[model samples]
Target: MKKIQLFIFAILLSSTSVFAQSDATKKADKHFAKFQFVDAIEAYNKLIEKGEGNAYIYSRLAEANYNIFSTVESEKWYAKAIEAGASEPEMLFKYSEMLKANGKYEASNVQMDKFASMRPADDRAVMYKANPEYLSKILDKGKKFNVQSLDLNSNMSDFGGTLQDGKLYITSSRNASRKNYGWNEEPFLDIYEYTVAEDGSYQAENLLDGKINTKYHEGIVSFTPDGKTMFFSRESFFENIYEKDSVSNTKYSVLHLFKAKKGSNGFSEVEALPINSQNYSIKNPTISQDGSIIYFASDMPGGFGKFDIYKATLDANGNVGTPVNMGQKVNTEGQEMFPYVSSNNTLYFSSTGHLGLGGMDVFYTKEIDGKLAPIRNVGIPINSNGDDFAFRMNEETGEGFVSSNREGGKGSDDIYAIKKLQPLCDVLIVGTVLDEKTGKPVSGALTTLVDANGNVLASKPANTDGKVEYIVECDTPTELKVTMEGYESNKVAVKGSNEEEVAVTVNLKPIEEIITPEQVVLNPIYFDFDKSNITARAAFELDNLVQVMNKYPDMVIQATSHTDFRGSKQYNQGLSERRAQTTIQYVISKGIDASRISASGRGETEPAVDCKPCTDQEHELNRRSQFFITSGGPKK
Candidate 1:
């Protein structure tokens, strides 16, 4: 009797275990079907705790984690599922996508390649592995950001401030002494005109007869590029007709785009846009400068996520076309709304998907050739851990504005202005002018700073120690030319428009001179082997010669060319003549008088560094060219 009772007890325990496992699976399926991924994950975790979770349960948990944007957690579960014998192509593809999104490019490529092979050459997997978003990786570096609240004081929630005709048009929710019809139990926001004084103080006044402010949430406003049309969001609540048994009317809120014609009476009647607003919630209409494209925030179907940004083209008949989703890169699984498209094709929007300080942070993504760049967080003081949204910047001045709920604010939300500190150019060019052979100081070296247009902006001379220091102010790109007698000049072009200071060391090569019986030395012109092309280095050398000629004003030089005895005498002579002509041409190219340089070829007639009866390397030293000052210049 005891044995039979124990067998019955074991059977009952096994039945209970099976029943619990089945119940857990059913609950997980129901939660997943309702798009409650967090709940589904919880159910899957309970099944795993009971030791009833198979490979399918682990795979489902991974999918749930990925759907909720928990990339790290999804990777963890996907690995567990794979170890538990789950090897679907879809699973591999999703794992690869997660890796790619997390910037694990090498691992992602390996998985994607595997998926492509298993799926018999899937184009998407192949293309993704081949041309991964490498540029996005570069953009992700040094992206640390922070947000600090400013001293912008306003009692009401103020935003959408734009600079127009030297004044600021700002919208505020502070309605004083007006009809107190609460807009959805909230104060109605209205546009106000403010004049920014030269001393940086603002005097604001309400515009229009309070007609634009309805008893609903109406903000997120902008004007056309020409300021002739005002575009804004208008909210209206309507009762749903599908619920017949419901006692209380179920009110559904829809955001509609409205335009006001600007004229003598300020703004005319506001009219609803031609686009149908029956199924989708469209708001925050921002038209491009050309009036051709309208960008707005919507929760329409086919979007990558909740409240993704969409773009609609205005046809010739002024009707908007079907809106297109911005894409998965811009729109994440979390809410991506409150778009503010600049005239320069940069889209600024508020997103909660990206790692932010807190709540929705403002981000900007530039569109180049129809491809959206990686979203960039407009760093601190503009965005914080708190909710920051509705970013607007003046196209005329780079001054920016953002609404924040950070600490020390007067209310729940306040509009703050971002003041950009102008970049300063504090670069100093310091170097010693030294004699090339002895390394001794060569004082009185002339230094000149010129812009890209070759116009001299500043000039100074070397000090007693042959050290010159110039405090050149460079707000834009410019060049510097340093020259001294008996030394090759140096010209360096620097990019300093965006940098604070740039320090450079200039090492000038020695100028060649032929020492004659009268204490004269022939100046040699060097050329690259087998090439008569004048490079920038050659040009710099010629510029120094021109400066010396200009100083003398009546100097003439015989440009002579010679060659080593490697080839026939006739061929050597032709080559030598061509080299001499090239030197003369370069001198003339530097704006020097062409008649001043007389070209002549000596072939192998003269050798400064003698190579006769020497090795081939020594013979090569005889190949040379020199410039003889024939008249008007005195040696220092």
Candidate 2:
């Protein structure tokens, strides 16, 4: 549900008397704006039955339905409103969002484009214009985590988890002993405890015996590093506190912050923070690593959106400072909640305002050089079209937990264990290009960094100083390729690590020298045992030979293939012949005339490096291929 939209709609509720053209319209408009969807629908449909419906009435009906997540009803009335000549930009915008929520992406995009055309300056339209393919990009972010739903999830809602001393504390609405919360028709939320296993699974489940579990709705919880202090959320009603609405007969109990200290008799010293208010809900508390800061989400005054993340200074004396909104960098016009601060000062929160795959996606912002980096969505399956939030991470093991109401959960909302695929490392690669012959620096050489999958991660030209620098992931294997005009391309393999910066020098040899070398020596052309077919890697080296021969058409060459010492002379001769023939046919396939290329099998007759006791490396070198210029090529 878009609660911010609901808040604004509630203000429009007052306009019912002004817009009251008739008795039926006044009652319908008031109910619709006041969030009484069933009453609003009944009132509006009564007027419609009398043929009194118009664009305004249909739009209001659609908005009221939308407030309750009635996508089908919302879509129908929105279409009716449009057909009745309602074409406001905001109308179109809401229609597009409704379509998107129903997974009608293509149709939604069409309406989005129309809305953008009308309100070109709107931020939502601008974001759509800038990155229409954002969904695929998010999908292409690939798996950053492996998530598993906890088996301890109950039949009702179970969410918001944290681990301390091998014990997992989770918020759940599964207590049969408590009264059902009217909001969701589920039992009131309580803090359930489970002992975590060595395999990261949990066992020995029970309700927290401490004063933490309550009768009202409890949300998220966290503890300090030393485990001496704990911070958690509970509804103000649990403290016998609330503000009663006279007309609506609603008791609005805002969430409050509470602190407790550990004692030998379990958690005992429990008290509410000074920041609790009867007017606004302040919840989802997470503490900083050093216990100096307490970060939480609130719907208080002076915020950027419906709910904003705020940080309060926690001094040694237990005094809480004024709450400060995180501002535009993390907050937006939509809800941003569940602020978690890592040891490195990285902030993790859930936001509906930011562009995401859908719903509230978990995002993180880290500071670099006194500036906040771009907030990155943690990506799915940690995220989904359904509400996914309440994220906390253990940076040491690269494992943590997130709660989502996505499909396949044992409950309406289940806590998921997530482990990061890779560690975050700040490793830089400094590349140097030089001439192999003269050892002189070669400037402007093109450099490319490729991962093991052969995907190009980055590309740049070496500076005037023959240096090209690119950042890489630590403990990740990478290959650096360098090339320059009139020089043979060279590649070097390296891994970025925590200890030091990786330096690589690509020695570019002149093209002429690589085409015809004095020794006719290169990396061995490997053959699998008794197999003559060329592998992909072997074919790559053969392509280089084809390039040289193609440049000099009249070149005549001889190919000699050998066998290792394991095979008998007679068996080796027959096996090596097939490889020799295969080599000749490969060159012929590259447009070299069959008569210009000849091949022979050496069997075990010639040994480049003789060894009475040969190692695998030596045997591999022995089972090789040698190319020799017979005539009309670079002179020997």
Candidate 3:
């Protein structure tokens, strides 16, 4: 096959003959150098028949078969080569790669360890020596994310999902009407779209259109935010363009990136990207947010590996820039593909190059301080010993999706839903929402939380006992909203930290739908102990005032900041001013008009609970923010 032939050539270029040679050996070397691997194998076997074979012969044979992905034969030859006292470190490295590709990771690691000791300066060897326990770590990390196979998978190959406008588009070989590909005996891949329901179910729809999904293969696709601009991979044969190798009588169809725009009817204005070539492929398009950047996997000449991930720039009018290889930090001398950049700018990709449980595994990388950190395997559940690729996630809910052909699936290469078991941050808030007056658990209260960007991070319904829980990033301000029909809707504001679990209690007041005459009373706007930064508990307490301001934008509210007896009067006065200013800023950040609210510091001079020799609990009660209506009071 072309796959076997190409891999053979790669092996031929790397294999060594580190032994004295004869006429037969020279002939075999010429055959191997000419990429005539079959002839080379026969010539080497003839030399063996003449009882003139050495370790070099066996090693080269192993390399040849290994590159062609002939697992059983390659393993047999490698064993023979080892028994013949082969001492080449590259032989061991290739053996390790072969073992890993065959899912024999323990054996692979052993071989890698041997190779590393022989050539410590080798980059891959150095990597292994630095983290000898990488396999165990990857095994442990996989447990943090849980995965489930989706029902939409068919008996045929179905994988590669991209969600846009609530529609999940995937590539599949399930069409009975399509012709089979000679390479894999599978049907040509077609883009299939599924309407994702509100309940997270997928219902298969028709092909995107006749333009994109042609008779030839159409692989993974990516779309811009507006779902108007699109980039996808297509078979070169679709355009009647391919390079014919006359010697092998084989025509190689180049996969290329195509850009298309959505019009009122369907996808049209299709044009091939300028970077596509007949010699190299640039496929698996993943457009970043804003459509200004595109990440893809390619074998585009200057790549560090077989298929290196690359990025290109796109302007407002879709003018393209040259593709840049992702660099050796993220690429190895092997195949890398299916790059997905998440909403948070974290890069997720699948690679056969990196060390993994086996096969292709999903990995993530992010730049910190302008340098890419070590590439991380997303861990188990998401990556199996199978070819797990096409990883994607929604940062808001921490829910992810991936495609894997791991055993026990509805089909070959099924889509999976990945639930993030690990929290997004070190901070967790677990508490209950209840009625302040009766202390009764508020059942069926709706809760929502917002990040500092004022984006709704999560929303959930309160369970029995009014229990509610959420996880947010450290040093981030989160606003948690809880609302019931009879109770005034309130928010719990929390500035998160590494504190594992912060307990918060939301005691909602059961109030009439309408406000009454006297100064509308609210629970104390709390502050953390000896600190002005808003506490998680106070965020909850202040959110109600935010709701009031939103409901009646014309109303004016004033917050009075106070402190307990821990400090001097003057110091407490300054601290209370900072606290009041912070409280006012928090209210305004929630979309409330800043002019409608004001803050003043009433120091320890005016304590809420004025008790001498006050207990710690009393001190906590005294450090609070009190609110009063400055204008637009209750109607008389």
lDDT of each: 0.61, 0.74, 0.74
| Pairs in steric clash, model 2 | none
| lDDT, residue 562, model 1 | 85
lDDT of 1 at 613: 71
- Deviation in angstroms for 346 in model 1? 1.8
Instruction: Give one digit per residue, the lDDT tens place, for model 2 in 244-275.
Output: 65655445567889988888866767899999
The alpha-carbon RMSD values of the candidates against the true structure, listed in the order shown, are 18.9, 13.7, 16.5
Candidate 1: 10-residue stretch with minimal lDDT: 1-10
- Estimate the TM-score of every prediction: 0.44, 0.60, 0.57
Q: Give the Å error, residue 420, model 2.
A: 1.8
Candidate 3 regions with alpha-carbon error over 4 angstroms: 1-94, 97-104, 117-122, 424-636
lDDT minimum window of 10 residues, candidate 3: 1-10
- Cα lDDT of model 1 by residue, 470-543, tens digit: 44433535666778766667666755554244665555666544233232233335566666666545566566
Clashes of 2: 0
Cand. 2 TM to true fold: 0.60
Least well predicted 10-residue stretch by lDDT in candidate 2: 7-16
lDDT of 1 at 421: 46
